[model samples]
Target: MIQLHDKQFVPFISAKEINFAIEKMVSQIEDDFFDETPIFIGVLNGSFMVVSDFLKLYKKPCEVSFIKLASYEGTESTESVKQLIGLNQDLTGRTVIVLEDIIDTGNTLEELKKLFKSQNVKHFKIATLFFKPDAFKKDLKIDYVGIRIPNKFIVGFGLDYDGLGRNLPEVYQLKEE
Candidate 1:
């Protein structure tokens, strides 16, 4: 168990499970883009650990970049997204793959889609390590997902609670009061 802020959370997904999921996704990506060079765009902070592990197994010729966006305060979404760190790559003719920690309302991904549109990106896909299908309201297909978890607040392996619990090897969900 772990405590973040004033709540207690128990182990939800173990590290081994995380690695397995990543490996599973890597195989799919290799098969899909084995002959192309795709740029892996990681949404910062939350995707740090996920992107790290993913690249270790991504042997195909690819590049990586990061952009930071925020729409949450602690465990709740403020329902507004803002770019903290803007993207600085010339993605004019590249296949881009967005690596995200999780997707809830999809506001962030929508905003990024707009950004990519403005850039004239050749093609792009979204990937999230964790997905909350029940909570996702936007009509966008998250191209790849590590796990489809219930609409529960989770923290660990790059997800955080007010800047804590991100370093935990296993993901944990809040304990019921």
Candidate 2:
């Protein structure tokens, strides 16, 4: 168990498990885009760690970029997304893959569609390290998923609780009071 500020969390996903999931996801990506050079667009802050690990395992040639979006405050989602950083790369006729740390309510995913709707990319896919199917509200398809988890608040491995436990190598689910 661990404490971050006033909340206590228990060990959830291990670091080794996280690495294994990432490797598996990379293999799937290689199968689909082995010949084509796809550009990876990581959702920033949370996706930094996932993107780093994914790129290391993916041997195929690819480009990388980031778009920072925010939709949470403390342990709850604000139910809205705000794009803090915009994509500057030209995505015309290029295959683009978005890497996300986690997908819950899919509010961020909706915002992403709007942002890229005008980019005119040849193909676009979404890849996330963690997914909460029970909580997903959007009709959009998530192309790649590393792990399917319950709709519970979690921290660690890039997911954070008020920006505190993001640096932890393993994941921790919020403990009941």
Each model's backbone clash number: 0, 0
lDDT for 96 in candidate 1 is 92
Model 2 per-residue lDDT tens digits across residues 70-116: 99999888988988999998999999999999999999999998999
lDDT of each: 0.89, 0.94
TM-score: which candidate is best?
2
Q: Model 2, which residues run further than 4 Å from truth?
A: none
Model 1 regions more than 4 Å off: none
Candidate 1: residue 70 Cα off by (Å)? 0.7
TM-score of candidate 1 relative to the true fold: 0.97
> Candidate 2: RMSD over Cα atoms?
0.6
- Candidate 1, residues 77-151: lDDT per residue as tens digits? 888898999988788889999999889878888888887887777778888888898889898778899889998
